[model samples]
Target: MLSSLIFLLGLPLALVAEPPTCTPLIPVTFDNATIPRLLGHWIYITGASKYGPHLAELKELKHAVFDLFPGSHEDELNVTEIMRMNETCVTRNTSKIQVFWHNSTLVHADDQVTSMAELIQSDKDLLILKHFNNNFPGLSLSARTPNVSKERLEEFKTHLHCLGFTEDEVFFTSEKDACPLPGEKTGEGSTEPQPE
Candidate 1:
């Protein structure tokens, strides 16, 4: 009789575990109309490998920009570009990212332009990207970004923690504001598209 009572109590306790929290969710999203300041220019990035979850550092960002699309109202649509670092899958590492921006209007630009960019989305706090088999489809690889406000960064870090990533697994550097490349210039009509 005592053992039966213990089992009943323990069963309730086992079934009442708290739901996990999303802590490490990076605040970076493609939906904000206000373009991010870090758009354009390359950024140095390091993060946990998506496949192995092992830490890896990627080469400099090839490009980062934010493009825009006008809405029927005054609102605009935002599409973020997350750079894929490897030409082919390597360790299924986290994608080497160069976050950029473009609008739905520019989706079918010349091959030269489209080849240089791709679209991504952030649902809730999960960062997702597009993938193609016969055609482009959703590739929602649960991800975390270091490029965000400290508060948001902590939140995302919590999410990462839930996903088994330690604090040392993720790192990033924004090169957009660093000293300009030789002869590089900013302001209107620059080659680099500003984040929207």
Candidate 2:
């Protein structure tokens, strides 16, 4: 009779579903020595997320280029995002990052944590980032140029599967007009398309 009672209690515990596991997540940048090497210009390629809003934002994102600069404080980074939306070159220069040990994250000036970043793969030319947020995790693939290779993209999909993300949630960036740099005199997205 006692054994029957124990079995009944254990059944409830077994019925509870366990949270999904994402593994084999190797670090792309681990220590201070390796972190510095990741800083530079990067072109946004594609992103995948289960969050509705984040996925929507990614879908709307045609193309983006960003520069990672050293901040006033150590282990901090200043990220300037450059994109073109509706013939308008939109540039945002306030996002800051606080690089941490192990897995790092993007932070704000107020010290508010934005999104946790995990590097999955980087071949100098291609990079993959997995972001673990409050309730949603997102994966991003970047490259030196918008033109990415088929192998890299396939690898990204494999990582996405491990994260429990679906192909429907993936958003591919459409490379187009790029915004001018700080002091470049070109109507990057201001005028009509030029002839070939």
Candidate 3:
């Protein structure tokens, strides 16, 4: 009876002495991102998916644009995604974005849907978004302008490699007229698909 009591008294201390294990692919976020800086039109440059089931369909998306605006709440933002589907159809999807700190080092933006991207890297000219959940793990690159410098592209590739992606896995979208011209209507049936 005395030995049993001693073991019980030491159990709590043993459990408290154990250290937590950190995963290699822990999510990261940028804390300096603000609404004004993130607002504006951005062009989709390239993307890499590690294990997405819809990767093939994503590859068929030849062009995309992300237009961000301030939301009704201070911590929210409205994001409009315009994507060219199958080289012909243009689809516009809008979602509300709520930016909050997942932790001290990670910032997460969720659209309250299947789209949740972590702000891994952001700069004046480039932004890198990472999506990893039960559905899939992917990385997307966007730029302020359609024409990204070669240096930046190389840097992006390096970042992908760090994230366990090879050159063959990375797919880059075409930059030719990727976005609609000013004043052009992007509604359904506004334009017909053209053959490649």
Better of 1 and 2 by TM-score: 2
Candidate 2 lDDT by residue in tens digits, 50-128: 6665666676677778877888887788888787554555677778877776445443342323566767656877667
In candidate 2, how many Å is residue 62 off? 0.7
User: In model 2, which residue pairs have backbone atoms overlapping below 3 Å?
Assistant: none
lDDT of 2: 0.70
Off by over 4 Å in 1: 1-20, 23-46, 52-147, 174-196
Which run of 10 residues does model 2 get worst, by summed lDDT?
A: 187-196
Q: Choose 1 or 2, whichever is better by lDDT.
A: 2
79: Cα error in model 1, Å: 11
RMSD of 3: 13.0
Q: Which stretches of candidate 2 lie over 4 Å from their true place?
A: 1-23, 102-113, 185-196
Q: The CA-based lDDT of model 3 is what? A: 0.66
Ranking by lDDT: 2, 3, 1
Q: Estimate every model's Cα lDDT from 0 to 1.
A: 0.35, 0.70, 0.66
